[model samples]
Target: MMITMKQNSRAPNAITSLDVYLNSLKVGVIVRTPGDFSAFSLNESYRQTGGHPVLSLSLRAASGGLRKDPKPVSKTVPAFFANLLPEDKLREAMEKHHAEAVRPGNDFDLLAALGADLPGAIRVVPSEGSLAVQPVREEGKGKARFSLAGVQMKLSVMKNTGKGGGLTLPLDDNDGQYIAKFPSTAFPGVSENEFANLALAEAISMEVPERELVEKSDFAGIPEDFDTMSDGKVLLIRRFDRDEGHSRIHIEDMAQVFGIYPARKYDGAAYHDIASALNVAISPSAALEFVRRLTLAVITGNGDMHLKNWSLIYRGDGNTPALSPVYDLLSTVPYIPADGMALSLGGERSFKALTADRWKAFAHRARMPEPAVLRAVTDTVALVNENWWQLPERAHVPDRVLDRIDAHIKTLTPILTSCANS
Candidate 1:
């Protein structure tokens, strides 16, 4: 079934609206309505435009044109649009910082303010007024054109841009190349944990972006208040959505693909669904990549690999899609010992779900080629076995956390049972 939205038939009047553009092509208009999310309508020209990248999998029809479902988002905007804005304290911080231009707790206003530099190649500017210029909180300091999702304390900064230039705040003209993640007081050593996880993922031949941990002292141009929020060291991950020339490369997550809101990201979807969609819309290789990445999450005890965590990248071409470079790799069992997988697979969400029986069942249920799926799992497990202990990034991981990861890995290695026979 195609993903569909129901729009309210309210009398058109003086309501605020935002122009949604993907790579300079006007895709649609979202009008603020008395609903959970604003109402949206696809632009007719965009519908006629050939070679435009798929905005969201939910919006496309089987005939290769925009679905004429008529209305979009009766209670809320499309999940794809909603996912563009930040969430939790980070979103609150953005609203607080831009309170001068927009209403508090208003997502529509927040999108208008932060839309210029959101994730992916999309831009949501006010159809009526000029795009909001970031208000300088500190005298003579450039405010970062900042708008990244997630609850982490992250600052978008341009790292080593010009001759002898170090870390600096990114502007509209000069967008950030890397996301500088700071230490979380609630989740201590998160940067270290991710660093170690990335290194381990690389060992298994996963495609991850360039990443490193940097001292807070090396950071420059961070807003005065944000600098205070940081601890000693930070993790910097290069953005994959932007190219060398800093143009936009489109991206979308499973939540958008499933046509569900972000709040329900962990629910109403599963790893099986993601793999199935990738195989159908993209290629078998992309589905295989998903298998390996989820295996990375499973062995590492990463319980936070929710729908939004997995994504698809479009390299400016409209139809072709691939799994984006791996990111947000965290070892969460140290913080929450009883945690489990974010999405269910083969009727299981626990660490013990990686059984040989479950792997075969998962492939059969997802309609994927069983042999290839099993190989992806066995390859991931084998690579982790061969290279995990000696990972150089282990130096960043604490001994306690490292021990926990090792313990988790041991539990999953036994899934190599039928793997050898496969």
Candidate 2:
């Protein structure tokens, strides 16, 4: 029911105390804290809709008693959609795709081998989504846990809360609720870029959820000397996941619905069979098809896409699961000197060799015909090219960053078009 930890600045690892609750609740994951006295609880309520469960939850803020109003909070996608999948069957499908992507002499399994870290830094939260983080035990260390309006914030061991630093805070800004990500050094850097890419993808006609780039100045209670400053960076982003004032439908992540879900090649059988496997509303074929198009987007160098990066939001009396608006979009290929592919595109960590041939290979593996893949590729490229420059100027992306994106677009267009048409 409860767990405790002290600040340990060592290698990236989950606080061991979380193991007890993770073993017990079967849904929650526990994390670390900067100080003491941060607490929260997650109570999920499921209702049947169209033969699928529409999950709604109340995130109660409590330390000793009933704290904030226990309003029902819902995300975009239902996790049960993945629950219907059988692991072995999905693995079989993945094997087939792996065969297609890996060349005879290559020492890598492009579509199936790369291990995808959990999506966004958020899932680093306890699986159960409830937490009772005792603040860091340093003298004069204020309660690291704080809330603004109705949203709450907490720190954790090096996990991706998208904070670009270790301190992950939840806030109610822009009249909507969101989790602000500040990643610690031990985590990945592409986390911030992915959020930018989310914005780009949404603008390019990809359906994603509504999100905003939150600034540190926009947040209160943070120390003026907080170690967030690095390499001239001064701001942070907060993701809008909950509209705290209103009750909405909730759909969870694919992994949350099933057991430990692996992030592998996007073309795996899991993509095609998750709906039926999980017995949720999404059909395997449709889910795989959606992923096919998404894969093309990634290999074309949208490398910021990851597991938690993609989600299903609820609509229509907040009961049905639909993809959230694309947010946090940016071109990492020419930006970040890390990997060239988004997290696990068609399962490959690097898309440097991704060509028209590889595109067809990926399509075949996803069970989507090559022609459909071609069309989707063409459409996405056109949309990105048409809107790339226009969007950066208006979105939260800074001007210098926009110019770099513009230059990168020119460099990327040839590859994108060739692959799409190929």
Best by lDDT: 1
Task: Please write out the lDDT profile of model 1 over residues 1-120, one tens digit for every residue.
Answer: 211223321111223677788877778888776554477788887778743677888877778666763354554456777787677777766666665555665666677666778888
Q: Name the lDDT of candidate 2.
A: 0.38
- Candidates in order, TM-scores: namely 0.89, 0.51
Question: Local distance difference test, per candidate?
Answer: 0.76, 0.38
Can you tell me which runs of candidate 1 are displaced by over 4 Å?
A: 1-15, 33-37, 69-76, 133-142, 160-164, 224-230, 416-422
Q: Write the per-residue lDDT of candidate 2 for residues 1-422, one digit (tens) a residue.
A: 33233333211122221221211122322223343112223322111122122332222122412223222213211122122122232233322333333222221121112111112111222223223232233364432222111101211111133545343322211121343544324323334444566666666656555444344444444533232442222223333334434222344444443323333323333432332332234444445446444643453355655443345555544434555544434455545545465433344455545556666666665566677666666667677767655655345544554555566556556665686545
**What's the true lDDT of residue 151 in model 2?**
8
**How does model 2 score by TM-score?**
0.51
Predicted structure 1, TM vs. truth:
0.89
Query: Which candidate wins on TM-score?
Result: 1
- Give the root-mean-square deviation of each candidate in angstroms: 5.6, 14.9
